[model samples]
Target: MKKENNTNKKAVCIMSGGMDSTLSAYMMKNQGYEVIAVHFNYDQRTQAKELACFENICESLHVKQKYILDLDFFKQLGASALTDTNIEVPTGGVEEGVPVTYVPFRNGIFLSMAAAIAEKEGAEVISIGVVEEDSSGYPDCREEYIQAMQKAINLGTKDDTKIEIKMPLVHLKKSQIVQEALHLDVPLELTWSCYKNEDKACGVCDSCRLRLNGFKKAGVNDPIPYA
Candidate 1:
């Protein structure tokens, strides 16, 4: 959708309807970018809830252009707990090394899709909320990895089409994310981080635990309900 009359800078934000990604979208909007929200339904365990949250967050952000893509191949791959029901999501704690919940090159695929969308939409930026410090030890969340992906994306696209992959939350801890989200007035309550439940957040899940810990450390109560 070409906004012939609009002159604002634009970004294609990869939102997962989770706290981090939702905050990223809001941050882009706050930076005066016309946010183009991109969400993927990768056959994850809580796809419906995540989609609902994505829609609600989009409404909050007043995002006009959104791409809700379906990648069913993730379920066929069946490696991560979020995609395969056979592998149980580890709720014990955020263990060392990569967690079972780490989807296989999920961000890479998402960025590739976002790059295509950005190129098509004439957007100059692609934003993602990948936390490195205090994260669940996912290797793909590293800043270097995202930088390399940015290089690859630029190389693959048209020569004149330059794109910047912005990961503002890459180095931030969850507590910092909470604080920034609050400062930006992000609709955190509309975000979903539960890896298992849809109706109410399973507070014991790794995702939920991180979110809860962030809120606790920030001294702000999470508006979302937990089980």
Candidate 2:
């Protein structure tokens, strides 16, 4: 009875305005999908900076359709260092267990939101930059978890809604991710990966450490500033 507005093959990409996420969005475009960039402001420490990066990245990607959703619940429920100022983001090195920076079920929540957009936009795919190997051991970044979410999303949406969650960097090491981003000509400088500090990246935070290490291993210079 209802006519659905359909266009070319489309994809909904959840970008954090970070290097990995930026690369994933680019990869989706390379795959010949009409990319709809979706970014969230969950009131993380670097929320403002990340939002800025997301805008710049979308411009570079030449994506006209974009969504920026502000979710203040993360600040209200802040056990993670990213959302709570009381908790310190780890800086020494990648810890053995899940770091304090792991926002509770962050990717799951993000994927759920992305799915809604995908189904509405008549998108066939959802892409996220969730790195598992050589990451800070975030449970939601695992391939199994993403696969499970994909199944759940398909089941929950309309019977004809077939959305596949694509984790381009899920299995790649940080170095490998860096290499792929470079190869894809993604605007890496427009991305930010710092977990602490806003102006200049702390360089020692878990996110910065991984990003720097990746560039080093890939023999590429990170264009972003560090303090």
Candidate 3:
């Protein structure tokens, strides 16, 4: 996302209340953009926790405008473990190829909704925290795929409405993400990344493992609790 000297520019940030997205929102704020926060409740396993975290993070960011959209359809069309109870969230580790945790075109759906919101709000950009280099193998997180989505979004929207989809963490490793978040003073404790167990993060889940590994690599202790 481009830094602006004026605060008139707006960004609709797709925040999942995770470390990466929280950091992205802060980066936008630091760049002098008025942020409009958006969170999706897709009936994922950790929906409640994520929502709570989103609210807290938004408060801390002093975000006045926000949207908490409920997307229950993701539960109905569940193939991924995050939205489907039938499928178990893998505790082993991140796997090669697309994992079961990769909701079919999840980011695409999110970006589509965000685009509509951005056009409605007259925002110039939409920010998301999709890490491709060091992340669970989700096809939609790829930078190439996101660039394609940006093109598709621009083509689909009104002629005058031009919105850029920005993924700041797309190429960053988890360790780098942690370092950046720390530098930005993002409230890491307010973020949740576990795919299972909302109360105490299941430390063995792919999300938890990745988060822990990031903190380890950064030589910082993770503030969130794990079980």
Candidate 4:
């Protein structure tokens, strides 16, 4: 692994092949930080396609480094639509309550892993693309959860070094995130957010709907293919 020379100014970005994560990585890179992307494959049925998209984006963007972590450990404790194909992915907004697609503590787990890698790589920040508007119903994606996780990382990794979890998009709406990414010239076409692993977005799934609405609100054409 090629380590960045800027010891105090490096960040590990969690890239999920989704617009949010991709934009988050671009934001960090644009900020002049040595950004490394971390992706996870947890035996989800859609993992293969998502991983392929992730790799392509990394290559196209010329990310300095990328790590694809095995997350079969999560499959062993499967309890979400993402890992359980039997559970159909929900389409449209989660109006009533938290949707079934909410992965079980997924963001928390990913952030923990990212923090560990950041500590090892001597990076001070771990950037994640969680947004309050899209992930508002997901408890783990809330501002309180992020703040708590940051504190936990600092305390747990005290022996290693201090680490902060950066949620630059956390407080922003989906439209706002899209606007920012557009401003940063993020390669939105390379992002993959559909729950269904098809050639084009299902256009009905919550993730797809959110992306569509965000792009429309931002007054930008979503470059990805959508059904």
On TM-score, the candidate that comes out on top is: 3
The candidate with the higher lDDT, 1 or 2, is 1
Per-residue CA lDDT of model 1 for 172-205, tens digit only, reads 9899999999988888889999999999999998
- Model 2 pairs in collision: none
Candidate 3: stretches off by over 4 Å:
1-4
lDDT (Cα atoms) of all candidates against the true structure: 0.92, 0.91, 0.93, 0.82
- TM-score of structure candidate 4: 0.91
- Encode model 2's per-residue lDDT on 1-227: one tens digit a residue: 12234458898999889998899888888877888999999999999999999999999988989999999989999999999999988888878888889999989899999999999999999999988888889999899999999999998999999999988888899999988888888889899999997899999998999999999999989999999
TM-score of each candidate? 0.96, 0.96, 0.97, 0.91
lDDT score, residue 112, model 4?
90
In model 4, where do residues sit more than 4 Å from their true spots?
Answer: 1-8
Query: lDDT by residue for model 4 over 147-220, one digit each (tens)?
Result: 99999898888675988788888878788888888787777787888887658788887788888888899888
The better-scoring model by lDDT among 3 and 4 is 3
Candidate 3 lDDT over 1-227, as tens digits, reads 34558659999999998999999999999889899999999999999999999999999989989999998899999999999999998888778778899888889999999999999999999999999988988889899999999999999999999999888999999999999988888889999999989999999988899999999999999999988
